[model samples]
Target: MFRTQQSRSGNDLRFSLLILPGLRRAGMVVRLLMCSVLLLALTALSGKFGEAQAAGSTAGKHRAASSGAKGRHRSVRKKAALPAKARTPARGRRHGRAAAVVAGATAATAAAAVAASPAAPAKAITTNTKPELLPRCGFTEASRRHIFSRGVYVLDEETNTPLFERNADTVAPIASVTKLMTAIVWLDQKSLPMANRLEVTEDDLDNLKFTHSRLNVGASLSRADMLHIALMSSENRAAAAMSRDYPGGRPAFIAAMNARAQALGMPHTHFENATGLSPENVSTPRELAELVKAANRYQLIRNDSLDKQKIINIGRGQLQYINSNRLIRYGQVNATVQKTGFINESGHNMVLRLLVHDRRPVIVTMLGSGTADGSRLDGVRIAKWLNCSLN
Candidate 1:
């Protein structure tokens, strides 16, 4: 048995040796196939890991998403919780926005109230009162400048405190500012409420040529309207009616005007007509300043002096009339109150009360100048220039 087993083993060895070369070739081919399969599997695994790392980094690489499967699970839950408001349709979005705005406003208001508790300072109140007087003007013998001024005077409503008295006290015809007195007298004693109707006839429009009036016949006006036109537009008809409708007639109104002048200590002043159309009507610039002060006391005239425009209802419709004083046009003080008058007798006359810088109030009256408008424009220009220079 031993000998037979040995013989078979030997034959098997001899058989194995004969096929060894072929078997080794087959083994080399198998080893190559196994290595190719391992390389392909490794490449696939590397691609998967690279893609997972890229996706994780894109999600902000936040600590909440970077801790393995637990972080990814939390990220998914958070994404499901809320989204942008725009994800919903725009229908009724305005209402939702309004509600959110109201909520935000409520929160802001609560915060503001808490911040502004009880210790805040109050705001200031202001009024259009007189500004401080500027430096005293020296147009005296010592100073040769300001030749056109002739002299300087601190002309006031109370008295002409003669700072430089040339012919300043000389009484002369003061023009349209005379209407201011006319309005004042009418307001004092008339048909109670002077805002009455006026029967404007052709007779009333007779000699108001150099002057202008848009008022027509059968035009109804409140006494307020008449006064407004009289002081603001310098309307002749309004002045005539105010004068004629006095206790008596034109005479009474004129008497009242003179009486008021006397009451105001205007000894050199006299008014013949409600309007200063007649060269016969005269007053000193000094006295007229005082007259203005008195007339302005009634508030109605002062209110009229500042009016920019007025629309009076005629029988047909409304007629627009603008104030003649250029200063208070549209409430800008080119001229706070100004009266312009020119009659053939009185060359051209003006009384202008203007606002100046530093809240100063200035009064200028011109009796006669060469131009038709009676240029106290020089005086106004001087005042404004001085204000600009000083301010």
Candidate 2:
């Protein structure tokens, strides 16, 4: 019975060992499954936590983007609400404001940006000033009414003020009216003897314009007689001889003529020759008005200029030369000093210092009259106008 028991025990022990190994293996497999279960639970928990974190981050980003958009919208609305004039900033200021607005600024920040911007320049305001009233005589309109000369200057001798004028400052050839200047210059010389006889030679002839002359070469006349005939008849040869007999000759005489013009304040007057034959002898009516006043100072000029007719001695016989100015003969006007000039280029020109209605001293200087008798007609019209207006 003991041997059987021992053998059974050994078999039992073998079985037990085998069963133990199996048990151990079963336990290990169960433990491994539990560990796997634990690891799966932890992983599920970690995944849930990560998903929550991602959702929170997305919500924050949305909030930030919405805040930025709302800020920009508010800024635009506020800017739009401003007045039309205020919203449009000046050139330089607008550029700065635009740069600040582009930089993702808030409404309050944009307002500050605009406030910090530079001020624009102010606009200028103009004020109206009253104009001056020109001097007017009662006869202003009447003076212009009857005058037909292309250039006319009427002056009040008492005041030496201009009464009426048309192209008065225009420079034009004065033609034989230049004799007035010649007569003035000749008489100005204190040393030259007026009674001294000056001979008319070939040099006295008008070679430039080839104008007709009644005074022949080799004829002799006193300086006073030459001047008288020159002024009265507009004798070309007599004027030439007067210039030739000047102390320093024609060139000196011409220089004196210009000097005398300047002294008389004739800014636009210029003389190229002694006689008026050259078209270069030019003056403005404004200047000639002053010249007429100056010429009227001399008694001889005033007398000779208005003389109806003058008797001049030729080579052997006396020749009577009528005044070129018809007004001196025909007109009822009492002219103190009168000079007439004519050329194809200058038209008809005249300068008259006359007493209107035997009371007022008026000077009428007309240039570029239409016809040969046009200037005389103008003079008569002016006199009639003055008489009617002054009375």
Candidate 3:
């Protein structure tokens, strides 16, 4: 019985030793599998975190570029909000099986390192767009009719009745159109001989606006020639020279201009300078229409104003001065009296005394036209309207 018990104890000891090593091997394999699974999970999580961080970084960059200061603060805050572990490299935990686990961890660490790497930055996009256009000068009313000029007046000369009016009472700068009044004042003083030669002086140069003139200082022209160019070509220097050559000079000539305006019942007319270079030379369309009527009565004024071109002596050579009133020069209307004027302050302006059907007379005045063509078109439109009204 004792011998049998000893043999059984030896067998049991040998079996226990064999089974213990096998159980250790199984536990090692299970530990290696657990480590591999944990590493893969960590690697995947790191990759996901990296993707999120890349997305945040790209968005933050866009925001920073879009907004100046506030977006920069938001980007800094987003980077700072990430957990310390997520921001740094993910490392695998050590186990009892050193060599096997180290190999797996090394592979996982390499993969996680690759996964956590920052992605390429996103590109910014831009768009090309066209520039805005300038605002047009005219406006359309409820009646659907557009008037380019700011002020307009049409009058029947025989009946002295307003045929059409648009802001006619608004007083504005008349510009070189003031030359018409200057011509009227000049013709009234018949004693000043038209044959008398007047020399342009430094006083005739436009000091107020510093405007250039072809008729230079020391240039001479007869009173009739001076008057001709002044009305036909809006010759500022010629008008100024005529004023300087008047019986009492420019001051007296200017006074006579105002006096004549008053005599013609133009209560709103005022002449500051003969050249109309001064913005103070102002008159309303209604008053200017009346002035155009008075100017038409003077045969000399009518003839000079209607002339398309006049040859004048300028000391060097004879230069032809063309009429500034395109409506009359182009024969667009039977304009008995016509004048056109412009200055920065006055814009484009025109006055016309038109002979209509049955020897009847019509006076049209346009002020503050946005362009030269605007004034001319205004005249054409009024003439057409008059023709339609008569029919």
Candidate 2 lDDT over 124-231, as tens digits, reads 101121111110222333344555689988787876656567898999999988999999999998888888788889998888878888788888788888988888
Better of 1 and 3 by TM-score: 3
Ranking by lDDT: 2, 3, 1
lDDT of 1 by residue, 1-391 (tens): 9999999999999979988878999999999999999999999999999999898778765654457557456666888674333232445989778777877798799889874553311112011222222212322232323324322223422232322234568877776768878877777774557545666666566374456667776776777777787787788887877777667787877888899889989888888788788766888767766766666566777778777788876656777777775535644344345666666666666666655563555566666666633255445544544454233
Candidate 3 global Cα RMSD: 21.7
Worst 10 residues of 1 by lDDT: 120-129
RMSD of each: 21.1, 25.3, 21.7
**TM-score of every model?**
0.56, 0.63, 0.62
Decreasing TM-score order of the candidates: 2, 3, 1
- After superposition, the stretches of candidate 3 with alpha carbons farther than 4 Å from their true spots are 1-144
- Candidate 2 global TM-score: 0.63
The C-alpha local distance difference test score for the whole of candidate 1 amounts to: 0.64
lDDT of each: 0.64, 0.81, 0.80
Tens-place lDDT per residue, model 3, 1-391, is: 9999999999999989998889999999999999999999999999999999999999998887578556556666789774332112234433434555666688799889875654322121011211111011111132214668999887877777676677889999999999988888888887988887888889888878888889877887889899999999998999998888888888999999999999989898899988888999999998998789788889988998899988887656787988887888788888788889999999999988887753668888999989999888888766665544432
List of clashing residue pairs for candidate 1: 131-359, 194-223, 195-222, 195-223, 196-223, 327-334, 327-335
